[model samples]
Target: MSKSTSLLAAVALVVTGGVALADDTKVGILMDITGPIASFIPPLQNAANLAVNQANEQGGLLDGKAIAVFGDTTGSAQGAVDAAGKLVNIENVPIIMGSLMSGTTIAAAEAVAIPAGVVQISPTATSPAITDIEDNDLMYRIVPSDNYQGEVLAKMVLEAGNKEVAVTYVNNDYGVGIGQTFIEAYKAAGGKITSAVKHEEKKDSYRSELATLSQAGGSALVVIAYAGDSGGKIVKQSIEGGLFTNFIGTDGLRDEALINDIGAEALATSFFSSPTSPADNPNQGTLHELYNAAYGEGADKAFVDQTYDATFLTLLAIQKAGSTDRAAMAAALRSVASAPGEKVGPGEWAKARKLLMDGKDIDYDGAGGSYDFDKNGDVSGYIGKFVVDGNSYKQTEVMQ
Candidate 1:
């Protein structure tokens, strides 16, 4: 072939390769939009979308290319695995955010991300086991682990003057992990646990389970389960069964759906702990305002703010790394989140973005609180306690 023909072939090859390189920066959002966790899922999904939109509006990462793909985890281990696989294989997304449930997150990390070299940042998966899993450097979470929350719960119950507590938890990673830690802490703190019951999810009724706790005669009942319809049923049944003891709950029960499902009257006397202080939280107010404007009222849920912060932090990491390479992005995540620098809040993304552009490192103080992520990607934040009154939660105290 002549020199002209050879030059034309080389140009075609360059253009084709450019198209492939351009596609490599796409980000994946893997979330639970259905199943038991749907109540919390929508808001978290909205948060992720809001972060991506804000980033793009501010000129995006890596020269105007923003996050692209979104997939649903369906709130199951199997579903998360499948979603991660699809995102990594079909969508070719190197960076993924999601699988909120600990079990589902672990499954996705082990079954898909680690093997595929995809970086997964979970906004709400709190099981300590997640970070403890061997060779799970790719896994990260924005929320404090159940280990801290469990100890917080135990201290909350102890301070509430509850000496004997009855524990009831959902038989899953999130539930069991917190429950076990709470038990250990409570016992070590000189409190006695009268009984422990682990219930399966999707049960029609927890009347018998509640009966067991009621009969245990504990001063307070600590529930470690998702605040889904089933959890609501259990709470209501426990209340109606004349188990009027004080109720303590973890982050999993910090959802609005619980009040809606069990009605305000039944949930009136309950107290629960969440990762953030929503009532006086400046970040929450900003998120609420933005969310209400975009999706109307009642869009902010327990993990929604953390989810937003997690996405923003990931984007910031990608910008810091100057590429979407999963491994580099993962290291950047640790660098940005782990302390010793300037703090950035939810509404201050523009400033953070500017600093990033100026080649200055930043530490993001998320809506969830001091997001000083450890080497294992776990955050340390104060747990806020709330009391249910009517259809809303009123922040009572900040548990240190």
Candidate 2:
């Protein structure tokens, strides 16, 4: 169908017995589409769309086309709540796929999804705080928590011979969770934190913070912020001010927009740590080929694999539950995502649907990892060490 027709079809909503039309199964997709993480949205959208498209092409969802209803969490807590409200109350989605930032995801979950009892699976919200939320099994994320990422990143930095570093992180959940953990881990492992600063976002300049940190005499700056917002600006201003030369960063700062804004030459000595797939996940290669074929590029973009996996898993849960009953989603999700079932990989919707129809269990191993969700609705995954390779990043090592 044409883009216009597809959109029109999406909005042709009708209600019957408190459920949507028989020909449509709507899935809510909450994304940070227009705020600090805007640069990360496009490819991630493609990944989510790819899952919906493949499901529709394969057999559709529960006898109808799986329509993706997106709610743009404008990268703020209020925005996230509002967006999720629409998805749950207005759209009446049985399941939700995201709100990528840690702050947004937690806000939406607390204010909306949890109370509403709609299952939410975040593709990329990695804040350690999420692991401790009183979600009652309604909240989940495909990526590992930032607690893991932070510990892994500390080892990556220390292993790179940066014994002392100045730290600057945006004063958000994403930044604070990873930043504090990294500092604690770094110091515990015989590294020194010269200075640590938590700054607010959208400031025109971070020169004053840079001056203080640069004067701390650290060999490197460890930045923990979104590249589209404070993180990119800090890196750019640092270069312009001739501040610290070497940098260590977490997933938030691994964006290509950083390289584009500051140029890769400035970050030659820098490296990043991000949630990554297993080094030997052959399904990753399959997902990449299909992704590139669909969008022409960006198969390797950050969170693309995770986003696709999250969406696909949500669909699988809905299908396994046999209806849009919100209460059934939690158990259905575990049945499809946890182990001891027939193995289903990416883009195997038809095969999975057939297995479910045959009253058999299926375990969905996606491009990112085999999602064995813990009791907290979190997964264990790999963290990758990356460096700028041309305009994008290249993973140099995978740490479990």
Top TM-score hit: 2
Model 2: per-residue Cα lDDT over 1-400, one tens digit each: 3463233223322222224467788999888877888778778878988998899889988978788888878888998999899999998999999979999999999999999999999999999999999998999999998888889999999899989899999998999999999899999999999999999999999999999999997889999999999999898899899997888899899998899898989899999999999999999999999999998988999999999999999999999999999999999999999877899999999999999988899999999989999999999999999999999999999998
Which tens-of-lDDT digit does each residue in 1-400 have in candidate 1? 2352233222211111123345336677777666676667555656777787777666766775565466666678887888788888887776888778888889988999988887888888888898787645788887778889888888888888889989998898888899899999999999999999999998888988888888878877888888774566677777777774467788778788887777777666678987774345677677778777876755446777878888887787887888767778777787777576677777566787788778888887666665666777776766788888667777788865
Q: Which ten residues in a row have the lowest lDDT in candidate 1?
A: 9-18
- What is residue 205's positional error in candidate 1, in angstroms? 3.0
Candidate lDDT values, in order: 0.75, 0.90
Model 2: ten consecutive residues of lowest lDDT: 9-18
**Could you tell me every candidate's TM-score relative to the true structure?**
0.87, 0.95
Candidate 1 ranges with C-alpha deviation above 4 Å: 1-24, 243-246, 277-289, 292-300, 339-342
Superposed Cα deviation of residue 98, candidate 1 (Å)? 1.6
